[model samples]
Target chain A: EAGVAQSPRYKIIEKRQSVAFWCNPISGHATLYWYQQILGQGPKLLIQFQNNGVVDDSQLPKDRFSAERLKGVDSTLKIQPAKLEDSAVYLCASSLGQRVFTDTQYFGPGTRLTVL
Target chain B: GQQVMQIPQYQHVQEGEDFTTYCNSSTTLSNIQWYKQRPGGHPVFLIQLVKSGEVKKQKRLTFQFGEAKKNSSLHITATQTTDVGTYFCAGADTNAGKSTFGDGTTLTVKP
Candidate 1:
């Protein structure tokens, strides 16, 4: 089976520019997550979706960042008026979405964004 | 808020040497999961520990969870060059309904 897929493996933009990324999780997976990983650091969760509903997004910067999983299988993360700190790799992962929360996540290759 | 910390930000060892990384959480974790990320690659899940004091082994790697479920450790025996990568521990808090990841320990195996 194919793994999670992401578009535009890499992107470069100037500070204050807007950017968007797309993700397509594996078939049959019901839970999806978006993470931001800065160089040399672990991934930080930005948002999570259980099917079409938002499960958690407390860490997301609502003022400039937003994500949505409209149909429950694909997702999009956007950053408006980006900052230099926003230059990082965006990763998307998915799991079986068990009610009890015990599932191994599968990750995509991720999109590396560079903001000048 | 829950915070996960990893020790020895980085490690470099000759092949056949042993290596260990520690993970500690400010609050008790419902479960802890380990992941490995190669340079320029995304993280891939390696294992998960759900029960307190649980110990699991895979080949030359051994994973241990603290009895209090607030800490965990990963040990690599006789490391090989293939083991070079960043290892991260993620602690899940059911009450918070989220998982927090440690900064990660980058391992370099000199062949």
Candidate 2:
């Protein structure tokens, strides 16, 4: 059973630059999520997708952040004109379905974005 | 907006000592799950509690869900160096599919 996979374990960019992170969830998983974890803080949910459709993205910064899961298996989260405040880890997680209470989520290694 | 809080933010203990962390929520939670993340690693699921006042144990780790379903605790006995990590508690809303995670409690074991 392979775990969730993410690309570019670490990234560094200047303020106002753009950055993107990719995530490939566990096999057969039906739900995917993107979270932002600032240092010393818990991971904050940015967006959630059930298959190719978005389930929730209320916390996403519409002006700067966007994410998509075109095939329902892989996802990409992008931040344009990134700010210093966006310096945090981008974590990707997956679960079997929306009934998460009955399912456990598997997380990827995460991409640490450092905005200077 | 829902919030789940965990404390104390950090703790250090001798290898043979015991440790515990608490999680509280502003609203009643339908279910709660726990995860542990080692330094520089991703969070791994530990356990889940659904019914109010449920208690589960795995080896030296004991998890308890409050009778009110708004609070929970994780207790570790005779901690070892391998137990060093941050433990997080996530609470799921009764009406929503997403879960809100707490800041987490970092535990350091002195070997």
What stretches of model 1 exceed 4 Å from their correct place? none
Candidate 2 lDDT for residue A1 = 97
Write down the TM-score for model 1.
0.98
Angstrom error at residue B101, model 1 = 0.8
Q: TM-score of model 1's chain A, to 2 decimals?
A: 0.97
On residues B1-111, what C-alpha lDDT tens digit does candidate 1 reach at each position?
Answer: 999999989999999999999999999999999999998888999999999999999999999999999999999999999999999999999988879989999999999
lDDT (CA) per prediction:
0.94, 0.94
Q: Model 1: clashing residue pairs?
A: none
- The complex in candidate 1 yields a DockQ of 0.80
